[model samples]
Target: MNEKLKKKSAKMTKKDGYKNIPSVDELMSMKQSGILIEKFGRKLVLYAARELQSIMRSNANTNTKDISSSINSLEEIVNKYVLKDKTIINGTGVIIHTNLGRVPLSSESIKSINSVNSSYTDLEFNINTGKRGERHKLLNAYLNILTGSEASYAVNNNASAIMLAIKDIVGKGEILISRGELVEIGGGFRIPEVIQASGAKLIEVGTTNKTYIRDYENAITKKTKAILKVHSSNFSLKGFTSMPTKKEISLLAKKHNIISIEDLGSGLLIDTKKMNLPNEPTIQDSIKSGIDIVTFSGDKLLGGPQAGIIIGREKLIHKISKNPMARAQRLDKSALSALTTTLKHYIEDEHLIKIPVWQMINMREKEIKKRVDAIIEEIPNNVRRVKGTSKIGGGTMPEAELPTWLLSIKIPNINTEELLKNLRDLPKPIIGRINDNNALIDIRTIPVEFDKYIIQSLNKLNKKYK
Candidate 1:
């Protein structure tokens, strides 16, 4: 430590440090304080002041000569808390990016959410009969229309849906699942753990690389409640891998008179073929294949609010809905509203024009190049065009890649990492992938509406560098 720092530390008592702490009202009068108050309210400003006071006390032993610099630090701290829930630009080509809010809700869904949340809604009331109604009933018709299922139920998330299903139908009973199909998705949610949490015993059958129909048949006992099939959406096993088909497993479950549930992790509603990609089995296909109960996520591939949709045989769905645990996992009015609109887009065949996920997935190279050209026209220097790939993220289609155009940036005096950090630290953070010692921004993931913001951010960077 410097001699001056040492002497200053020796002279300052903890009480002396407290005396230097600024009042919350003093911070409230600083530049950008009104913006902070509007963003986080006065309550958070006071909280931030106390936090800063604590930090000042702890660091009292060193450097307190620059009061202006310390105030700036406190202002920065307040801004960070205000931006905690703000949206950032996804220049990173990973669509449905988990870390950055998986599945951006469509505008129509947002409208629906706003409409429902702005005022009183018929959340649990039947306007038709002037009677109390079920909350899940709102999605039942839309789900059945889009999925060809006899009935449907809504929950807060896929994990809760699965837990309720098992606790209702397979409590303390055995659930036969293929060892090959056992998967650990993002956030470390393992299939076996979920089953165990639901009070069901997992009956692992066959090898990790292969499982035959007979493997499941052999494992079935009088205690067996269901045949559980988990779609390993996040990963795949190549070469010499085999697992029982949905048809085979469904037939086996039918013969045994037990429930069959398929956990379609991504819950893709659109046919991948229509998007010029390989097929992911749709909920309709699962129902046709005799899956008695099906649970899937609403956000991934569906491009809706976070939810778990359960749609299958009417009897089984009713039974699952009747579970006491279902109430604990029920969807709120906002989620239900968003999900209903999202499903309606599919039913009305308006998703192609309305849903962002499918629109981005089907983006052509020519279209992406046009977007890139538009961006380059504004800020041309150091922005190199290149061929790159985007992904269908959110633990779905781990192998699927979308061909696209990308902008690789090289700021003259700054390292790529620092440049990337600068973009991320912008007022509206621009998130991009680092490739080949450059920051690669995939325009496919960037909405056309944000093009001006991207240009403005780059222009500001250019000015700063100049």
Candidate 2:
């Protein structure tokens, strides 16, 4: 053949190689494909198959081995595109871990959620009057008993709660806030930004360390509408730091004939000092101090669904609830159901025993050590019991650390990072931390029911690594 013709023929042969690559129809006929289709829907499986075919064609190789390997890659592609939010074993010992779905609902709360989610509910229907009812009044009685507030409202989250309060009460007016009390909550949501978003002017007063009540008084003018006090929930300022008390701020706002609002970033119903942790002010404390309005999170320290709860005087709460944003930020039926159940736990004086957040917080060190000892006994590897600390995470308590026991695993010839990855790759991913080149599993955040999954994962790792 001529040189040009030879080159053309070679290119043709290479192009023909792709003819052996499986089509979407052919791939869908495979038994393995049927399994994947059953696990993931047909549409996803088909998309994965088409993607695999494209990859195989791009490589310009369609040998039998390559085709078989590409077929096996179908599941990998589908898994990669699948939803990643699933049940995970949190061995990270940080109770209320934000990334792991902070504040796991109690059994009662879960039951309430499932009950409300699976069927029609009286969410806004007034069965007593045979007419439509208001959902906002559902939690009033529960919150009134818990926080001693004249009225209460719940929105989607704490940020929304504060925003609604500011916009409704202080629109186009100056809101005084101490420089030290200006805090940024989780996800970079700052107090000043919230104020600005509400169309109100932010008057930052005093230094970052010290802000007397006089500073607030000095900042107030004819345009001043409210005084905002934000709790530094995720951080603490130590020596030389001084801010006015909640009572003082409330008194100052009263003297100026303006609103007083306090954002207790993580709202607490129970006392933390009783659990041997640092004192965190409760929602009731804010109300008792004569604050006209209080905002706090339901998911963080409250051990409820993600909600922004506002409690204050009847008139102030009524005004805030009348804002159009309140409807847009209101909680759904499922969240309200779960939150009501959670509140019931407190009302019945069973919060520490029934609510998962409090249960995890109040977990005794000896009980945690016992679980660690049992886990170490089950895993036949280079695992040892070690002392560690559990944190009250989710931007609640920055300085509180509870004593805990950890299972430190150091397998031969395996690095700590690789070990953690392997554990994560298991069916039920086990999330842990590294300590001094060793993999540490702190079971403080893990419930006892999930211990078997951890044991199984560790045993499987031991066998594979050994």
TM-score of each: 0.89, 0.89
Q: Model 1 RMSD to the real structure?
A: 4.0
Where does model 1 exceed 4 Å of error?
1-42, 53-69, 83-85
Cα deviation at 217, candidate 1, in Å, is: 1.7
For each candidate in turn, give its C-alpha RMSD to the true structure in angstroms. Answer: 4.0, 4.9
lDDT on C-alpha atoms for all candidate structures: 0.85, 0.89
Q: Best candidate, lDDT-wise?
A: 2
Estimate candidate 2's alpha-carbon lDDT, on a 0 to 1 scale. Answer: 0.89
Candidate 1 colliding pairs: none
Query: Which lDDT tens digits does candidate 1 get at residues 74-142?
Result: 776776676464878999899899899886888989999899989999998989999998787758988
